[model samples]
Target chain A: MTTATIIQSLASGLLMGLLYGLVAVGLALIFGLMDVTNFAHGEFLMLAMYMTFFLFAFFAIDPLLAAPLVGAAMFVFGAVAYLLVVRFAMRAKANIGMVQIFTTFGLAILMRGLAQYFFTPDYRSINVSWLGGKTISLGGVFLPVPQLVGALVSLAAFGALYFFIKKTDFGRALEATREDAGAVALVGIDKNKVFALGWGLGGALVGLAGAVMAMFFYIYPDVGASFALIAYVTVALGGFGSVFGAFAGGIIVGLVEASTALILPPSLKSVGIYAVYLLVVFIRPRGLFGSI
Target chain B: MDDAHSKRRLRDLIVAAVLTCIAALVPLFVKDVYVQNIMVLTLMYAALSQAWNILGGYCGQISLGHALYFGLGAYTTVLLFTKFGVLPWFGMLGGGLISAVIAMALGYPTFRLRGHYFVIATIVIAEIGFLLFHNWDWAGAALGIDIPVRGDSWAKFQFTRSKLPYYYFALVFCCVAWLVTWWLENSKWGYWWRAVKDNPEAAESLGVVVFNSKMGAAAVSAFLTAIGGAFYAMFVSYIDPESVMTFQFSLLMALPAVLGGIGTLWGPVLGAVILIPLTELTRSFIGGSGRGVDLILYGTVIVVISLARPEGLIGLFAKRRKEVAR
Candidate 1:
C-alpha cells in the first residue's frame, strides 16, 4: 500500500483501538473476577446503544450525554441479572459452561427479539456537532473531530479505571476477589457482594463504551455482535481476564484489522483476524498476557 | 438374560418399523406442497441434529458451529457438480471428505478448549469461514453460487417437479443417522465417549486416549453433518453464505439436539418433529409480511425451555418412563 493509505489506516486504527480497549476492559474484568463467561454481555452493549439512540432522538442529546445514564441503568441491570439469573444458576450446577451457555444464548435471543419488537429492526444513528463538523489537518493527513474526541474520552476512561483499581478500596476488594475468592471471603469481605459489584462495574463500562460507539457507528440489533466478536478475539489474544492485556490486545487487533482492510479488500480483513486468532491460540493457549 | 433383552429389542424394532412406514406415507395421501416441504425440512433437521449429537450430545462438546461442516459439505458437492460435471451421488462423498478434513483441522486447537471456550472458538471459526466464503472470488462471493438444475436427472440430483423424492431422501438420511446413533450407543467407542463425557480424568486413567477419542467422535460427527449438507444443498438447489453458513443456521441445527435430549438417539428426532412443525406454523401465521411475532414466540420458548426443561422433551419422557418402571 501507499504511504498515505498506510498513514490513514494507522490513524483510524489508533482511534478504533481506543474504543476497543474501552469495550474489552469490561469483558476482562467480569471474566477475571467471576470465572463466568457472560454470553449475553454483548446484548448489554446492544441495549445501551438503543438507549443512546432514544436519548439522542428524543431530546437532541449527544451520545456522550447519554453515557452516564445508560451506564447507571445497566449497572443496576447487571446487579439484577446477577441476583435473578446468575444466583440461581450458581446454586444449581458446577458445570458453569453448560448453565451459562444456554442461559446467555437465550438471554441474547430474548434481548434481540425485544429490541426488534420495540424498535422495529430499523437502523438508528446520532449525529454529534463536535464529532463531525470539522476536520483537523495534521501535516497532509485529515483526521475527523469525532474520532479524535472518541479516542480522548476512551483514553481518559482507561486512565481513570487504572487509577481507581490501583488506588481505591472498592478496587482493592475487586482485585482481591480476582486473585482468590475463597481467600477474600476468609478476610471478611463478602464474595457475593464483590461479584455483584464487579458485574455492575463491567456492565457500566460496556454501556459507556456502547454509547460512545453509537457516535461513530450506527445502532442496530446485530451491531453488538459485530463489535463483540472483535472484543472476544482481542480478549483471547491479549489474555482472558487481564485488563491491561485487553487494552493492548484491542489496539493490536484494531491495527491488524485496519491495516488488512487497507491493503486487501475490506471483506477479507475478517479472514486475517481469524488467522491471527488461530495463530495466537496455537502458540499461546493462555494468551499473550494470560495470568496463567 | 442377554437373549431375552435382544428379543425384547427386536420386538421394539419391529413395532418402530411399522410406525415409521405409516409416518413415511403421510405425504402420499396429502398433496399440499407446504406441508410436504415442512415434513422434508423437519426430517433434514432431524438428520442434521442427530449427526451433531455424536459430539455435542454423547461427548458433551456443545459445539455451536457445527454448521461449518454442514456448509462445507453443501458447497463442496455443489462446486464439484458444477465444475467437474461429476454426478452428485458420488460428488457428495467428496463433500463429506472435505468437511472431515476441516473438522480435524479446527478440532486440534478448538477441542483443546473444552466447554465455553470450545463453544466460542467454534462460533468464531465458523464466522471466519462465513466471511471467507462471502468474499472469496473462487466461490462467487456475495452473489452466491448456483447449481444447474438438470431436470428429472437422478445423476444430477435434480428431480423433475415433485417434492416427494426430497421427502424420501431426507427420511432415509434421518433413518441412517438414527441407525448410526444406535450402533455407537452399543459399541465400545460409544462407551469410551460416555466415559470421556462423564469423567475425562478417570477415563484417561483407565487407558482411554481422551484427545483421540474426542477427535474420532468429532470427525464422525462432522462427516455425518456434511452428508446432511450435501442433501440440503441439493434439496434447496442453491447454496449461499446467508442460507447455509449463517450463525442463525448453526443455532437452528443445535436447537434440535437441545430440545430433544442431547445425548439420546431419539432426542434429535423428537426435537425436530416438534420444533420444525412449530417453526413452520409460526412462519405461516406470524412471520408473514411485517410482523415479528414469530421471533417473539421463538425467543420466549427458548428462554422457557432453557430455564425450565434444560434436559429437553426427550429427557422429560425418559425420566417419566424410568419413574414408572421404578
Candidate 2:
C-alpha cells in the first residue's frame, strides 16, 4: 500500500478508537459504579443515532447541535431506567445476576423492535451541506472533517468528564459510592441520587458518542450490537473499570484492527479483534489496567 | 434406598418409553410432508437444546456460542461427504471430533472468567466464526457449501424418496443426547460441576480440578450439539453460515434451558416441548412472508421469561416450598 493509504488507515483507526473510547468510558463508569452489566448499553447509542438522523433529516438540526439534546434526553432515560428496573432488580437476591443480564437483553430487543417497527429497516443518514465535499489535509494525510470534528468533540468530552469526576463534589461523591456505597451514604451524600447521576452521566456520554458516530456510520437497528461488542472488548482490555485504560485499550484495538485489515482479508478482520479479546482474557484476566 | 430409587426410576422410564414409542409411530400415521418436516425440525431442536443444557444449564457456563460447535459439525461432515464420497454415519465422527476441539479451544480461555465474562467470550467467538465462515471462499463464502445428491442412498445420507429417514435420524440423535445428560447427572463429575458452578473458589479449595471439569462438560456438550448439527445438515440437505451459524441460532439453544429451568435435567426437554412447537407454528405462519415476526415474538418472550421467571416454567413446580406451621 502507498504511504497515503497507510496513513489513512491509521487515521481511521485513531478516529474509531476515539469513538470506542467514548462508549467504553460510559460502560466502564456504569459498570464500575453499579456493578451491573447493562447489556442494553449499546442500544442507548442506537437510540441517539436514530434521534440524530431524524433530527437532521426532519428538523434540520446539525448532529453537533443535536448531541446535547440526545445526551440530556438519555440522561433522563437512564435515571428512570435505574429507578424502574435496576433498583428493584438489585433489591432481589444476589444469585439473580443472570436475571439482570437477561432483563437488559430483553430491553435491548424491545427497543430494537420499537425502532424496527417505527423506523423500518432502512439505511438512514444525515444530509448536511457542510458534510458534503469536506476534506482536510493534515500532516501529509487526508482526514475527513466529520471524523476530525468527532475526535475533537470526544477529546473535549473526556476532558470535561475527567474534571467532573475528579474535581467536583458530585463527581467525588460518585467515586466515593463506587468505592464504598455504604460509606458514601454514611457521609451525608444521597447514595441514590449519586447513582442516578452517575448512570445519567454515563448514558449521556454514550449517547453523545452515538450521535457523533452517526455522522460517519449508517443507522440500523443492529448497528449498536456490533459496536457494543467492540466497546465491551475495549473496556476489558483496558482494565474492566479503569477510565484511562479505556483510552489505551481503544487505541490498541483500533491499531490492531487497522493493521490486521492491512495484512488479512477485510472479512476476517473481526477474527483479529476477537483474538485480542481472547488473548487478553487469558493472559490478563483483569485487563491491562484493571485492578480486579 | 437404592432399591426404592431404582424402582421409581424404572417406572418413570416406562412412562418415557411409552411416550417415545408414540412419537416414533407419528410418521406412520402422518403422510403429509409438512408435518414430517415439522417433526424432523422439532427433534433436531430438541436434541440441540439438550446438548446446550449440558454446558449452559448443568455446568452454568451460559454459552451463547453453542452454534459454533453445531456449525463446525455440520460443515465438517458436509465437507467430508461432498469431497470424498464418505458415508455420513462415519463422517459424523470427524465432525464431532472437530467440533469438540473447537469448543475446547474457545472454552479453555474464557471459562477462567467469572459469570458474564464467559458469556461475552462465547458471543465474541461465535461472531468470529460467523465472519470467517461468511467470508471464506473455500467454504463457498456466504453462498454456502452444498452436498451433491448422487441418487438416493441410505449410506450416502441422502434419501431421495421421503423425510421419514431424516425423522428417525433426528429422533435417535435426541435419544442419544438425553442419555448423555442422564449419564452426566448421575456421575461424580456432575457433582463436581455443580460444586464449581455454585462456587468455583470453594470447589477449587476442595481439590476439584475446576478447569478440567468445565472443559469436560464443554466437550460433551459440544460433541452432542455437533451430532445435532450433523443431523440438521442431512435433514435439510444444505449448510450455510448465514442459515446455521447465526448468533440467534445459539440463543435458540439457550432459550430451551432458560425457559425450562436452567440447571434441571429435563429443562431442555420441557423447553423444546413447549417452545419448539410454538416456534414451528409461528415460522410456518410468518417466515414465508418475510416479516421477521417470529424472531420478534421469540426475542420478546425470552426477555420476559428472563426478567420475570428466570427459574423458568419448571421453577413453579420444582422449587421446594417452606412448610407453614400455623
Candidate 3:
C-alpha cells in the first residue's frame, strides 16, 4: 500500500473519528453521571437526523445552521424522556440493569415504529444542503466537506463541554451528583434536576452528531440500529463513564474501522472494530480512559 | 428437603404433567395450520426462553448476544446434514455440544467483566459471528443454506406432510427445558447460582463457586438454546444470518423470561404463551402493512411490564398465592 493512500484513509478516519466521538460522548456522559446505558441512544440520533431533514425540507435551513436548533430540541426531548421513562426505570427495586436495558430498548423500538409509521420506511437524505456533495483537499489528501465541518464543530463542542463541566456551576453540580447522589440531597441539590440536565446535555451532543451525519448519511427508522452498536462499543471502549474516554474511543474506532476497510472487504470492516473491542476488554476490562 | 419446598416442587411437577397432557392433546383439536404454526412457535420460544432463563435469569448474566449460539446450533445442524449428509438427530446433539463449549469459551473473558461491559461484549461477539456468516461463501453467505427436503422420515427430522411431528418435538423440547430448570432449581448448582446472582462478590469469597456456577449455567443455557436453534432451522427449512443469528433472536429469547419472570421456571412458558400468540397475531393482522404497529404495541408492553413489574409477571402469581396462604 502506498504511504499516501494510508495517509489519505487515516486523514478521513481522523475526521470521521471526531464525529464518532461526538456521537458517543453523550452516551459516555450519561453513563459517567449515572450508571445507566441508554439503549435508545441510537434512536435519539435517528430522531435528530429526521429533525434535520424536516427542518431543511420545510424551512430550507442548511444543516450547518440547523445544528444548534436541532440540539436544543433534542435537549427537551432527552429531559422529558428521562422524566417520563428512565426515571421510573431507575426506581426499579429488582433487576435494575435489565430494567434499564429493556426499557430503553423498548423505547428504541417504539421510536423506530413511530418513525416508520410517519416516514413510510423510505430512505431520505439532505440532497441540497450547503455542504452536501462537496469535498476539500487537505495536505494532498481529500476529505468530505460535511465531515470536515463536522470535525471542527465536534472539536468546538468538546471544548465547550470541557469548560462547561470543569468551570460552570451546573457542571460541578453534575459531577457532585454523580459522585454521591445521596450526599447531594443533604446539600439541597435536587438529584432529578441534575440527571435531567445531564440527559439533555447528552442528547444535545448526539443531536449535533445526527445533524452532521444527516448531511451525508441516509435518514431512516432503523438507521440508528447499526450506529447504536458502534456508539455503545465506543462508550464501553472508552471506559464506560468517562466523557474523554468516549472521545478517545471514537477516534480509535474510526481509525480501526478505516484501517480495517483498507485491509478487508467493506462488509467485514466492522468485524475489525468488534474484534478490537474484544481484545481491549479482555486485557483492560474498563477501557482506555476509564477509571480503574 | 424442607416440607414446603418439596411440597411446592411436587405441586409444580403435577401442574406440569397435567399441562403437558393438555398440550399433547392440542394438535388433535387444533387442525388449522396457522394456529399449529403459532403453537409450534410458542413451544419453541418457551423452550428457548427457558434455556435463556438458566443463565440470564438464574445466574444473572444478562447476555444479549445469544444469537451467536443459536446461529451456531442452526448452522452446525444444517452444515453437517447438507454438506456431509448426517442425520439431524446427531446434528442436534453436535450443535448443542458446540454451543456449550463456545458459551464457556466466551464466558471466560466476559464473565469477569460486570454489568454493561459484559452485556456489550456478548453483543459484539455475536455481531462478529453474524458478519462472518454473512461473508462465508461456503456456507451460502448472505443467501443462507436451504435444506433440501429429502424423504419424509424421522431420521432426517423433516416431515413435509405433517406439522404434527414438529409440534410434538417442540412440546417435548419445552417439557424437557421446564423439567431441567425444575430439577436444577433444587440442585447444589442452583443454590450456588442464586447466591452468586444475589451477591457475586460474597459468593466469590467462597472460592470460585460464583465463577463455576456461572460457567455451568452458561453451558446448559447455551446447549438447550442451540437445540432450539437446530429445531428452528429444520422447522423453517431455511437458515440465514438475518433469520437466526441476528441480535433480534437474542432479544426474542430473553423477552419471554424477562416479562414472565427472569429467574423462575414458569416465567418463560407463561411469557411465551401470552407473548408468542400476541406477537404472531399482531404481525399477521396489523404488521402486514409493514407499518410497524405491532412494534409499537410490543415496545409499549415491554416498557410497561418491565417498569411495572421488574421481577416479571410471575411475581403477580406468587403474590396471589402468598395472599391466599395468609
On lDDT, the candidate that comes out on top is: 3
DockQ list for all candidates: 0.43, 0.46, 0.82
- Residue pair clashes in candidate 3: none
Give model 1's share of reference contacts.
Answer: 0.29
Residue A96 of candidate 1: its Cα lDDT?
42
Worst 10 residues of 3 chain B by lDDT: B203-212
Please report how far candidate 2 places residue A259 from its true position, in Å.
1.3
Residues B97-137, model 3: lDDT tens digits: 99999999889889988888888999999999999999999
TM-scores for all candidates? 0.93, 0.92, 0.99
Candidate 1 per-residue lDDT, tens place, B1-326, comes to 39976785676467557757986889879899989989999999998999898998898888888778888888888888888888887767988888888888778777777444566678888998888899877877888788887778666778858999888888888888888887787788888999999999999999998898888888888998999888988988878888888887788888888867678778788889988898899879777843466766776676566666666777687678689989
Model 3 chain A: which ten-residue window has the lowest total lDDT?
A283-292
- Model 1: iRMSD? 2.3
TM-score of 2: 0.92
lDDT of 3 by residue, A1-292 (tens): 9999999998888899899999999999999889999999999999999999999999999999999999999999999999999999999998888889889999998999899888889999899987888998877998889999999999999999999999999999999988999999899999999999999999999999999999999999999997999999998899989989988999999999999999999999999889999899889888877883
Report, for candidate 2, the interface RMSD: 2.6
